[model samples]
Target chain A: MAEKKRELVSGSRLVDENSLKERLIVIFTKWEVILAVLIVFEFILFSNLSPYFLDYFNLMNSTFTFMEKAIMALPMIFIIMSGDIDISIASIIALCSFSMGFASSHEIGAAGIVIIGLLAGLSAGMVNGFLVTSFKMPAIAVTLATQSIFRGISQAILEDQAYTKYPEKFAYFGQGYLGETLIPFELVLFLVLAAIMGFVLHKTQYGRKLYAIGNSKEAARFSGVKVDRARFINFTLMGLFCGISAVLLTSRIGSTRPNIALGWDMEVITLVVLGGVSITGGKGNLFGVLMAIFLLGYLKFGMGLINLSAKVMIITTGLLLIIAVLLPGFLDTVKARRKLRRQQKESGMVEV
Target chain B: MSIPTSIKTITQRRETSLILLIGVLLFGVTMRAPNFVSVTNIERIVNDTSILIMVSIGQFFVILTGGIDLSVASMIGLSGMSAAMINQYNPGMPAGFVLIIGMLIGMVLGMINGAAVAYGKVPPIITTLGTMSIYRGMTFVISRGQWVTAHEMTESYMNLPHGNFLGISNLIWWGIVVSVIMFYFSKYTKRGREIYAIGGNKVAAKFVGVEEKKIHMTIFTLSGILSGIAGVMWTSRFAAAVNETAAGFELQTVAACVIGGVSIAGGSGAVVGVVLGALFLGIINNALPVINLSPFYQMFIQGAIVLVAMLINTLSEKRREQELLKGRQQ
Candidate 1:
């Protein structure tokens, strides 16, 4: 009995806060759970407001709208997780699409066009990776400069002209179905990639290094994390995904314009951040982000059914982002204060 | 402190090299288009750059405190659009009153951002990112997607920025006045020093009794006020205000700050550098038209120039660090 009391007084491991009651609270209060509940709530509300909101086919089709962005968000998770950002992703898309269009116009087959798009995006990403990792410039600065440069290259070449022709079968990636399923090819591709990325993030040492770097770059370096190499790879990964997204987008639209994906950077960043990813880095996960993508996608699709203007959706997104960041921060502060008070009380009793 | 060291310092200064580069640019442009170096063209370029100059100064303050306000373009749009609508509906409203109202609107917007960042602990980028679109959305809502055209505005309102003052446009005069006042404010004020201190090292600055929150408030609000002024100038000069007015303009202001050698990490920027950077951009823009290059090429060239300027800024800073280390070793 005396030994048990002593252990209780000093043993943090023995305290096992994972009791049934605590576990229930933790599971229910998880961000992903909250998002799931919110999505369900959105569904009921939208269905009541609009009759066609519940259709399964329409739901499946809605995935096409965000699958490209969702694909881009996979690598974006790594970028933000490592305390870097690439606002140039949308611009990379414009450049890649332009290159692919150029290749198609040259009578190249679908395979060659796809190769050109990926190469364009890869080289573009490499430039950003090189600028950031080698020059030690801030990620925002390098990306902002490159954002302008990449899009500008396309604008200078295209000059208000658009490329309209693509080789046959090129549209399959964007417009085709999976064998006999109603699922989009892009959607299937996203799911497979997301699963792979999720495993790499949660089941690998590389993932742990990202978290360490995000929490403290200096400390991570001292601990021998390959910080620079990891960051470079994240950027290149973002570029490759952008290429994939560009291929999908160009195929779906069947044309490439200079202004294609003009404001997509904002939308993509919003998705990641709203997915419960911390803008400051070192927090959040894939489950939360995936939920955020679907919730926002469906919310937008439902709003369209009711004929609500895109402006209202913009306002809603802004409010949600602010609330998402603020509510959690507020909760954390309260938790911290309570813990601080308890610590003081325990210390005071010991002194007395 | 010695003569040789002082001379070396002068040579190493960014401003010195920037001035030399400007001279080269001017000479090169003159060689291509002989009339480009003329005084009239120079005046025109400066006038055109006046709006960017004001906006860059505003951006400079926020960046000094290691914060970015991505909503700058949106702020410009809403404020400018608001003032333009007032002029369109009530043509009798004084231009000065419209300008003041525009500034007040911007000040309020900035205050919201400052409060969230300084007190609420929301990251500056996220706060601004959200506001960026929200403000634009609000602009559309208020305007009902209608543009305020030049013909709808009063004669006096249109002339506010274009009115000549002793052969110089009022816009150029406004830029000069703002430059002088800001230079004085930054150099002489304790608040300005606090901005630098906080940016350099937040923990150290807080320990030294600097109020990080208040500085954040001041700088962001100041940026808003400046953007407001620029908004008014833009509408008057361009003679139209639309929902998309000044869209994507935040990039140009930031580009000016970066090219002017403002460290993106913050805490170090000068008004002269910002002004020179704006001027350099302005010259390139004007010269591009004269050289017969399509305006489309302008975007490509501008991006390239900013990249070069960014690289130079980094290289020079690194060189300064090495030189300092060598001196310490000696």
Candidate 2:
């Protein structure tokens, strides 16, 4: 009978733990649900606003527009979550694009072109990471300087030249579709990249280290996590991704200009913030970021379809970014108040 | 008070980064074009220096607060466009009024930014970044994508740049006046020291009863005022204005401040250093045009110089920290 009583207590404790887990999941799932609902609402609203918004071709083009942004946002997630930032990604893209232009001028094949572009991006990223870490500089400052440095290099190489002599097959990566449907190659690439990044960030040890480092670098350092190594690797990864984006962008535009990706850094950063990542670091989820990426991309695309100027689209992006960064803190305050109220009510009843 | 120790201490803490950067820049320019020192070249340097000085002064204030005003350039563009529109609408209006109106509009925008950053609790970088888009968008909206033509602006107004005052362009005089005022304010004023105090330790300053929010707002507004002045100078000198004018001026301004020893980390730097840095940058820019070097090569070299400057600053900072550690150990 005593054994049975002890078993009952353990069973109840298990139940309580299970319920706690369920509660956490329930709260976390709300963000995804809200995002899905938002997307559906946006689609319905846009379709009502514009007759052509529902067109497969228009939507397909919209996917292409957001593809590089979404792809680049992945590494940026790791970068920001690790308590660092790189605003030079756009400039990195320019450098990569310019390198490709140089390669094409030298009659290099596609494979060689890809390698060279990636190498340029990696070197740029490494330099940025090295400077930031070794010199103990802020990531923002380092990247700001590198933005000019990389873009300056690109301008030096390409000047006003537009490179366009690639084979028609090259266009497939940016503009073509899979199985002759309405999807673009860039969209497919975005999906593949997003999945890989999600796995790396959510399912890997290194990913956990990123979270730990962001939470507190000192703690992570004491815990045997290699802080600088992770940062350096992540920056290099960001550059590699940026290089890939350059390849897609060059193919899509069918030309390369020195100013091709000018001012894209802020947009990517905006998306990263809107995805619910704390700019101050330590906390974020990839899924929410993906949701935000699509939400923003589609929202802008929808706005574009309704005849908004590109300028207005940028303004809207800025607003969304501000709201996204601030909203989570507001919600936490609300949650804390509610918890306090409930605790007070319970204590009052017990006293009574 | 041993000689070697004192020498080591002075050497460790001194900001030799800017000095080294200036030396390197002088050497590079001298090598590229030995004749880059002609009177004609000096005049060119003065012309470029005027514009950079205006922007650098504004950038210095924002950087001092441990925040950046990315919208400064956009403000310049917006104000330039507005000032030109006013000139085109009524060529007879006092040029001074047009300049004031443009600057006032800029101050308003900056106030909005400061309000968002200080009261709304938005991060300064993000706030300024947003305002940048807003400012530039407003410029495009107001101008309707039209350029302010040279003919629309009056010859007398355009002549202000070509005109000389005290054997220097009025533009250089504007730079000098603004720099002197700023240097005086930063060095001698109570609010100026408060700016440094807040940057050095915001928590400590707050503990000591520093009004953080007010100072932030003031600095941001001041930055906007300077940017507006720059807009006026830029428009008057170019005799034209467009939404995309001064496209990269914000970066250039920041570059000048950084190269001049203005720390991005904040609480450190001076207006005088920034002015000298601006002159250094201006000389480099002007020399490129005179030497007939590819503007592309000039850009490459300028970027390299900025990198080298940052590197030297980092090294000097490390040396200082090492000396401090050594002192503690001894």
Top model by DockQ, which number?
A: 1
**Which segments of candidate 1 are over 4 A away from where they belong?**
A1-29, A340-352
Error of 1 at B44 (Å): 1.0
Cα displacement (Å) at residue A289, model 1: 0.9
lDDT of each: 0.88, 0.81
Tens-place lDDT digits, model 2, residues B91-124: 9988878878878977887788888878777778
In order, what DockQ does each candidate have? 0.75, 0.47
Interface RMSD of each: 0.9, 1.7
lDDT (Cα, tens digit) per residue for candidate 2, span A1-352: 2544873575465457567764553354355666677888999999999998898788878888888878889999999999899989999999998888788878888787878888988888898888888788878878887887888887877777778787666677787888867777788888888999999999999999998889889999999999999999989999989988888888788788888888899888887877777776777889988898888888888888899888887667767666665556566566557557856987999999
How far off is residue B144 in model 1, in Å?
0.9
In terms of lDDT, model 2 sits at 0.81
Write down the RMSD of all candidates, one decimal each. Answer: 3.6, 5.2
